[model samples]
Target: MEEMLNNMREEDIKEARLMLDAAVAFRGAMSSAMRREIMKRFCELAGLPFDEPPTIVRRNPFEDENLRNNLQKFISEWCEVDEIATCTCHELYDSFSDWCMCNGLTPPTKNVVGGALRQMKMFVSYKSDATRKWRGVRIKEGEER
Candidate 1:
C-alpha cells in the first residue's frame, strides 16, 4: 500500500537523521562537505533529491504553509521558547503528531514534519541542555554555535 510505503520511508528518513546526528554529536559538528556527502548517500538510497548540507529539506516537504504555521503556533503554545529554541527533528515530529491527534486530524509522517520544520527554520539536531537528548536543534541564522 502507498500509505505503508510512506510510513516505511518515514522510518528510513528518521533512522538516517538519527545516524547523522550521532556522527555530529560524537565529532562536535561536521564539516559542510562531510554533511553533504552523508546527505547525498541517504538521499540517493531514499530516492529523494540531494541538496546541500544543512539544507537537506529536499523534495516535497509539506508544501502547505498554512499547515506549517499552524504547527509552529501549536508548538509554541505547549513548549517554552527556550525549550523549542533549539529543538530536534524527533521532538518536532512528536509535537506535530501530538498536535494532529489533539485536533482530530490525520498526522503527517515524521519525514513530512522534519521537512516542514526545516522550511520553517526550526529544525535542529544537537545535544540538548534540558533533556540532554539529541533531537532537532533550532539555531537562529548567523547565530549557530
Candidate 2:
C-alpha cells in the first residue's frame, strides 16, 4: 500500500514540474502575483515550501529527505533556477489521487515501480503451469487469464 502512495507522490512532483514549465511559458502574459500564488499553493499542499522541493525516493517507504530547510527563500531560489510557479500543487495532488483510485491502488502505498516490475516474474511463472500451457495468459492485474 505504501508503495502505491509513494508512486503517487513521485508522479505528483513530476506533473507539478510540467505545470511549472507551462507557467514559465506564460510568464510575461500572466500576472506575476498569480503565478507566485500558484507556486505557493502547490508547495503548501504538497507539504513543501516554495523552495524545498525534496528529492522523493522509494527506497523503503514514501518519506522524503529533510534537507528542505527554507520555505520562502527556497521558493525564491527555485523560482530563479527553475520554472516553479507554472503548475499548481493542487492540480497535481488531485490528478495523482484520482489516478491511484482509478487504478485500484491501496492506501499508504509502497514502491510502485517495484510492484510493477514484479509483474514480469508473475508472467514468467504463470506459463510454467501445465494446466495453463497453450492458454491465453492475461497480462493486466485483476483481469481473467
Candidate 3:
C-alpha cells in the first residue's frame, strides 16, 4: 500500500493542489450560502462528489440538568475543600455511580461523567506533576482560586 501510494503522477498532485486552492477560496467567501454554492460548483467542475455528509450533533452530558446536579453533589461530598483545585475526576466516577445507586438515582456512566466534567464551564483543569494527567477544579463565582 505504501509503495503504491508513493507512485503518484505529477498531474494528479497538481490537480489536488488546484482543488485545495479552490476550497480555500470558497471557505473565505463572506456569505455561507455563496460558499456552499461555490463548493458545489467546484465539485461539479472537478467531477467530484458534491454530496454533503450528514452532520452528527452529539448531546453534551454537561447540558443535562440531572448529570450536572450529580456532578455538583459528588464534588461537594467527596472533594476536599483545599484540594478541590488539585482533585482528579477520573477516580470519582466509581464512587459517584455508587452514590447514585444507593440513593436510587439514575447512575451516570463514567464516560458521560468524564465528558460532562470536561465540558462544564464551572470546572477547569490544572497542570499536575503527572505528565498526562490534569486536576479538575470547580470554579467559584466564575473565579479561579
Candidate 4:
C-alpha cells in the first residue's frame, strides 16, 4: 500500500484524498447499511475481497422534464430581454406563482426559480433604491406585475 501510494501521481493522489475526505464528511448522513454497502463496492472495485450488489443512485427530481418545460414556457410567454428592463425578485416570484396557478402547475420555490434563472444566464443586480432585481429581463406588456 505504501509503495502504491508513493508511485501515484500527485494529482491522482489529491483527487483520491478529496473524495475520501468528502465521504468522511458525509458519513454522518449515511445509514450504517448504506455505508457498509458503499465500502463493499469500493473494496470490490479496488480488487479487494467484498460481496455486495451494486447500488443505483436515484435521479434528481429538480431536473424533471415537466418542470423544465414549464419554466421555459413561462420565460418565453411572460418575460422579455431588454438592456434597460429590470424586475424585482418579489415581483418575479409573484408573477411566476400566478403563471403556475393559471396553468394548473405548482410553483417552484423562490430559491429554485432564482437558481434556474441564474443557470439561464440571467444576472442579478441591485437598484439605486437597494431593491434586488434581475438585469436584462422584465415582465412583458399585458402581464401581471
Which one wins on TM-score? 4
Flag the better candidate by lDDT, 3 or 4.
4
Model 4, global lDDT? 0.72
Q: 1 or 2: which has the higher TM-score? A: 1
Error of 3 at 116 (Å): 1.3
lDDT of 4 by residue, 1-145 (tens): 5454456667655654555566788899877687676666444444457766578788644565676678778877888878888889888788888899999888989877776676556556566587778887788777342
**Each candidate's lDDT (Cα)?**
0.60, 0.40, 0.60, 0.72
Better of 3 and 4 by TM-score: 4
lDDT digits (tens) for residues 27-59 of candidate 1: 556776676677676666567677553555564
lDDT of 1: 0.60
- Across residues 1-145, which tens digit of lDDT does each residue of candidate 3 receive? 2342245455654554565577676676546666566667555545567887567799777689888887788667655344345444554565677668877898877678777877775555554566222354422331221
TM-score of each: 0.40, 0.26, 0.42, 0.51
**Which sequence of candidate numbers ranks them by TM-score, best first?**
4, 3, 1, 2
The clash count of every prediction, one per candidate, is: 8, 21, 0, 0
Task: Give lDDT: candidate 3, residue 25.
Answer: 69
Best by lDDT: 4
